[model samples]
Target: MESYGFIDCKDPKYVDTVKAIERELLFDGLLFRYKNNDDFGEPKSSFTVCTFWYINSLFKIGEETKAKNLFDQLLSNSNHMGLFSEDLDFKTKKC
Candidate 1:
């Protein structure tokens, strides 16, 4: 959406995409990159970048309050150095 400049526009497709992402990837307010099992095993963590994208998507879709709340929650899960890893544990939120 950002690459195509669709983030600033209130497009129904963007809204639908956000809704679909929320329904399929969102877990406990965090966003997972995928649900399928890879060669290693089923994914057990949420991708930090994907969650960040979700935050932006929420704000772009007129869900500012939700976006802000989720942003704060994400921040709170960060490490003592105020850094997030590529992935966060889904249940415990450990990096």
Candidate 2:
């Protein structure tokens, strides 16, 4: 599914609904699961997908510097092979 721009979470037709959901996810810091009643609850740091989305969002909102910083942080999370895996440990700084 398309996660970027006005299709899934940012649809204009559902602007209010989208914004509300985004607000909850972005500000309220909620982590949702793929299936119903399967929440992992709050997390200390952002997830891989969310971090990528944040970098994209920063670029989309014209915050290039911030986006670059975020990009660097995300890059630093990569393993020695320069690849990201399904299980990444941001704390230990390993993948």
Candidate 3:
């Protein structure tokens, strides 16, 4: 499987494209939902992977403060056992 950001052949525009996609995923709700259309045309109720990706992307883009904020948000999604399962219900604010 090809990785999203891996570039075996260095293209001058590669980094720019990756950064643009990352920013869009982080900030554009419409694009995010559209990309994950399989999950009810949006994200699942609990999405640890998505949350983690957001944090990772922030760090990759040199936004340490923003990355920390996203990290805190992901941590907040943990359950009573300090563990995050598969889904987080945004409406109920529970995982």
Q: Whole-model Cα lDDT per candidate? A: 0.90, 0.51, 0.55
Residue range 1-95, candidate 3, lDDT tens digits:
01465552135354465467566554422113224667356664545566576566546656679679768766776788888766556555466
Error of 1 at 31 (Å): 1.0
Query: 1-95, model 2: which lDDT tens digit per residue?
Result: 23534365343444454344355544222222221333554443334566566556556545579679757867877787888754344355444
* Reference-based TM-score of each model: 0.92, 0.52, 0.58
Return the TM-score for candidate 2, rounded to 2 decimals.
0.52
Q: Point out the worst 10-residue segment of candidate 2 by lDDT.
A: 27-36
Please count the clashing residue pairs in each candidate, in the order shown.
0, 0, 3
User: Which predicted model would earn the best TM-score?
Assistant: 1
Off by over 4 Å in 1: 6-8
Give the clashing pairs for model 3: 45-88, 46-87, 46-88
Runs with alpha carbons beyond 4 Å of true place in candidate 2? 1-46
Residue pairs with backbone overlap in model 2: none
